[model samples]
Target: MKPVSLYNDIASTSYPGRGIVIGKSADGSKAVIAYFIMGRSENSRNRVFAETEDGIKTQAFDPSKLVDPSLIIYSPVRVLGNKTIVTNGDQTDTVYDLMNEGQTFEQSLTTREFEPDGPNYTPRISGIVECENGNMNYAMSILKSADGNPDCCERYTFTYDKPINGLGRFIHTYMSDGNPLPSFEGEPTLVEIGNDDIDTFAEKIWNSLNEDNKVSLFVRYIDIASNKAESRIINKNK
Candidate 1:
């Protein structure tokens, strides 16, 4: 059996609103992006990812108490295939639509609002495809939260060769949005197990996480030459 390693397992609960994990999948052909918008409020508790003509759309499943949701959970672009984009709140479809119409990356994000979690602006994480050749690049920004009333924000980007065999720099900031920016500092961890070991590893990781915090876990592999990729998302609550 091929030896597998731990990549990153960044766990965060800072936003009373949502949690997003974006990175490269093991075997590294496709990008891995998981978003879980959670809250005690009824609107926040509902899920919001749906397929759209251009790409994907997010709408309050309940649509009752959700306020200004358009700016809160939208992604202005989507990078799929060789490019894929995922955001927790909105703008997801907008991004997809623009990209489908041939808009440039930055062009797609031009009108979207910063994240709502500020000091980090609602935190937005993205996994951008670097080339038609299938390489991965990523970026995320957080605007200041309401507590700061404004005047605080943070932006970070990690774009490089894919590292599926080991760990890379994992963000460490907490849900509090404070400095000393928290991170999973140990050598990066990789999660590339053999097909045979996936079940066991999945069980271990799934059983170990808290019920509410446990979101979806996806793994993918690709043959660079063929440009074909295989992937899946393990939604524990499903």
Candidate 2:
């Protein structure tokens, strides 16, 4: 599929819910990863991406204002060896734990499904980037309801081996805002991953997102040869 402009795709939607992007930098020197959260409710918006030892976790910007933590709070990004795992919910732990037990990324996700939120059944979008021997590969998955039917779950995993420079895949929880938010359909959108440093890349994504719905964003660039990473976090609350 032809790559579409990342900024335009994100700016076109008022609420994409949560999203994950994995790609290679234009210079082909760094492995790029981006994850962002957007919300329509108070509980969802009252969040900030806090840096953890391995990755980043969602925490309430205002502790007292947090109404429900069940679905709102989660470690969206985690690191395991040379692999980086990112997801929309607690499934991050599921992938991390299962993978620790020698399970593949796709295998680890088999034990989980879409969120329980009715009508919407928000899809659990996930991504993993692995780097070794100066080579990088990644995969993205979406565990969603079968056409909004809770009785069935549909899973899709897209793998990229030696990804092309300046290109990436974009996946999110919703297609757009609605009475009952619609789950994202089809494969992840092919997006342009321009040559930008961590800060510039983060700014581009943060600025493209809907101002009122976007909560927090995290962007990281990992050097394929050294396995070193540089990251940036942007939170609307602060």
- Best by lDDT, which number? 2
Q: Per-residue lDDT for 50 in model 1?
A: 51
Which 10-residue window in model 2 sums to the lowest lDDT? 179-188
- Per-residue accuracy of model 2 over 1-238 as CA lDDT, tens digit each: 8999998999998999999988999999999999999988899999999999999999999999988899989999999999999999999999999999999999999999999999899999999999999999999999999888999999999999999999999999999999798999998999999898888899999999999899999999999999999999999998
lDDT by residue for model 1 (173-227), tens: 2343234223222221233433323345445444443456443333333334454
Give the whole-model CA lDDT for all candidates, comma-separated. Answer: 0.42, 0.94
lDDT of 2: 0.94
